[model samples]
Target: MTPEELTRPWPPPTPKPAERGAPPTPVPSAVPRRRLLRWAAVGAILVLLVWSVQGTGVSVGALIDGREGGLHLVRGFLHPDLSAAFLADVGSAVLQTVQISLTGLLLAAPLGLAGALLIAGNVGAPGWLRGSARAGAAFLRGVPDLLWALLFVATIGPGPAAGALAIAVHGAGLLAKLGAEQLEAIDPAPVEAVRLTGTGRAATAVLAIIPQARAGLASLLLYQWECNLRTSTVIGFVGAGGIGQELAISLRLFRYDELSTLILAVLAMILLVDQLSRVIRRRMGAAT
Candidate 1:
């Protein structure tokens, strides 16, 4: 080799094809197709949003025109009734609501856990049994808690019992579905190892599966309790008995101040439950 060639860089940069007087490589068709699909999806979403807004009669102008009425409502909410007698009644109703939620959760927990065990794929339950349990859970979930409350009220007469039963029936379905998913997501290795130790099917599940999934199951139950508490309040509107009944009465009598008090109570209950659930979940995660 020549002296200049030997002194040159070991790895030299190559010139571009265009610089070499050659045509650029053609772009792939798939790239343009993907971009087209993305734009189409965005356009479809925009169209659906516009259609929904028009169908729902959403109007900023109407909202602006009703400002006075809105302000009046706001003022009433800001000035909740705090009389001693009313406060006593409110406290009682709140307690009843709590009772209903607890009763429902107690009834639902075992039923839900059993259903979850049956439906979980890794549990080795009979296929038919799993399918049946899943179907039953679906049916329960399909029927709203309000409808359940209505049914119980018609059959057993209106009271806290009806509300509790409604919450239980609906919550069982939710818990079963959620718990099954959690169980299915657990580490299969532990389950397999437990089985190899001559443990029976049920024993294996008890020893291996449940322990791993317990944290998730506990969190689900807490969430369900929060939901049950909210549902108990609403079921009272149908005469099932709770703070919701009082809310309905207040609204019918144009007792906006009382209504405001009930709303605040509900909000406070929700916040308390949320905080408690958060703390429990944090502690569980730390323990795990």
Candidate 2:
């Protein structure tokens, strides 16, 4: 606090330069390359989509031009051949189709459930066993349903029997795969509790696992039913015996009226099935 210290340029004053005006604000450099890349990527995707549509002959303009033809066709279907004779044939064909679907679904359900259990690792199998089951299911799924029907036809001769068997085989594999996955994703707590209760494997699976997975099981069955219905149509094409056979014959004979009627009938059947399935599923979900 001496007077001299205070007065002696504060002992040793530091020279400070005045603040140079604020350093120039940063200006981002333009990235032409990045912008170009973004635009190029968008352009490339557009080009690819356009080329795909063009290659497939999917011309929107042409579709628009043919809209009237489509309308006429639809009108023809609305006034389908409802003659008594044709009606009899339609009734018979429809009965065959339904029979095939129901029978196939029945056959597929248990088999599919078993396959799913094995493949989805719900069953206490070794990894290799599970893998093999899964692989087999995948193989079945990979083959076209028509191919399966053809194989059955070639081997066993053409008929509803061939159709049913083909559908059954494929349906089993599909349902099994789905069921197995549903089993895999279930609440393990119940399964563990079942085990802890000294329950056998079969009891544990049936009571603890199956109940929990019932919704998925039902859904899979219903889905397979839908698929089987479509499949039955295809089998008819190969003489596996269904409305499809009649359809093929009608087409070959240029029986446009009959063909239209048949198509309408098939469409009605599909729509009815779809509605019924939806209702059933809704009821199930609600009950659960």
lDDT of 1 at 32: 84
Cα lDDT tens digits, model 2, 238-279, are: 988889988989878766778899998899999999999999
Point out where model 1 deviates above 4 Å.
1-28, 286-288
- Model 1 clash pairs? none
Query: How much lDDT does candidate 2 score?
Result: 0.85
Q: Could you tell me the lDDT of residue 208 within candidate 2?
A: 87
| Candidate 2 segments whose C-alpha is farther than 4 A from its true place | 1-40, 60-79, 197-203
Number of the predicted model whose TM-score against the real structure is largest:
1
lDDT of 1 by residue, 115-158 (tens): 99999999999999999999999999899999999999999999
Q: Give me the candidate number with maximum lDDT.
A: 1
